[model samples]
Target: MNRRQFLCTTGAFAGWSGGVACQARAEAYTVDRALVLVDLNGGNDGLNTVIPIGDPLYRALRPTLAVPHDQVLPLDERTGLHPSLGPLLGAWRGQELAIVQGVGHDAGNRSHFRSRQIWDTASDTHEYRDDTWLAHASLPAASFVASCTDAARSIAQHEAAVVRIALHGFDTHENQALRHAALLGQLAQGLMMLRARLIASDDWHRTLVMTNSDFGRSARENAVGGTDHGAAAAHFLMGGNVRGGLWGAAPRLNALDTGDGLPVSLDFRQLHATACAHLGVAPPSSVERFAPLPLLRV
Candidate 1:
């Protein structure tokens, strides 16, 4: 109905419930599902990550940074994944990965602090809310934070109700080619390995692995072989129950906003709501107005 109420249902879906929601319902959903959040610490380059190989405009936009068309791991005739993320191909084939493209409030607010606040609260670009979504959800909003690169391994062992991981080194302000390649390789490997571990422990089916950054990098490469911060990013969702495949329209490179950034096709709240729906939480009327994304299996 209202912004805070929208976030209230959303926080539960985002895995910040902290058992507070469960206490009221008697601990039913506690052990069944857990959310694994992979926060690409800095803005990730979405254009390169989800390469638009068929779009001539993409190569024109980032000639130096574009992955050779021949090398792209083809998802469709028009779309492909960066070579560095080759490890994820198996999941793609198995239908365990869902790629949501053009996700963000808008191509505005390039400031990392501001963008993250907006995401954390599921606020639209035009609105800013002080309270966190978790507090509104009636959850204590607790966390079990570990900053190590190897924290994924540790996270598998503990299996908290929710785990938010920050993979550093995405802020590729200079020399983005080499830096982004290495980071993407690491990301792909980490995701594949995490899935393998979950499968071994019989937790893969219930664990949802989602990735997002503060925002997305510019659609065009800068003179320094890097990109400046922009708005809108493509995100990935992987899990046994995930309805794996591409979702939403690709970022419209030909049609750029005033910031020369891709316009937001699907609001970031839609992504949050998809995850919330996966956890069987009803969307508040506000998010429901955006409609449903069948991101999870029935």
Candidate 2:
């Protein structure tokens, strides 16, 4: 199927009905907070990003690819941040960052397109959805913006309640070290820049920043020194009001699934629900089964 046909068939058209309904209800609700979603398009190697320094199993599993204990910035005795994420240490030290471990759905699908669709629609592995959860909720005109590389620019130009930034190139199937480091560095630098701008404009307190991905990479490295698509990666939530600290326990490297992938400790929908609460709106009816996480202090 062509791209347009595929999108329409999968549920992209499902939003028109909800959008109309939401427009009618929008007059009754008001929210002052803003949410920024940073999507890492490729499956991120969570094991390398958030090093489990104290876990013996991690070092044993990927001796060559593991970030050495000394290289990581310790968040606690057990875990630490990757070296390339040094720019984010300030947020962590100020208690404005929360690391949520093992964020993914059950029965993970490794395909890039399918997994991303599931995340975008917040659907189960067996189900197909066309409309994104965001489209089901209405806001004021020009209150939401979605972009792949222009989120920062768009945020500066438009007064939106929600902004989505999608960053690609996390799929590191070969020579991962160099590619991953560059990507992480860019992410760190961009976030720091955005934070500084927001704080200077006195908008930081009202804004929330979070990161997600299609899935996590395998714990074990391949022959080429890169990880394959896996499941249950780590995610981050940061902002002035975030309840900074670790939200979920790190996955056990030794107790991997049959495919040598980390088991999910936190479902991603919880994060979405939290965003809905922050924006003063109810979550999409489809995700009522999942509760919002206590990640914000507001």
For all candidates, the clash counts are: 0, 4
Query: By TM-score, how accurate is candidate 2?
Result: 0.84
Which runs of model 1 end up more than 4 angstroms from their true locations? 1-30, 134-159, 282-289
Give the per-residue lDDT digits (tens) of candidate 1, residues 22-93: 332312223355566677878898988999887899989888999988889999988999999999999999
Cα miss at 21, model 1 (Å)? 19
lDDT of 2: 0.74
Q: When superposed on Cα atoms, how far off is each prediction in RMSD?
A: 5.6, 7.4
What is the C-alpha lDDT profile of model 2 across 1-298, one tens digit per residue? 2223222222222334222222222222232466777878789888888888888888888878888778898988988988999999999999988899989999999999999898888888999988687632222222122132233333343334566665678999888988988888877877777777767666677778888799999998888988999999889898888889988868888778877889998888888888777666667765767898888887
Pull out the clashing pairs in model 1.
none
- Which candidate has the highest lDDT of all? 2
For candidate 2, give the lDDT of residue 279: 62
Error of 2 at 61 (Å): 1.2
RMSD of 2: 7.4
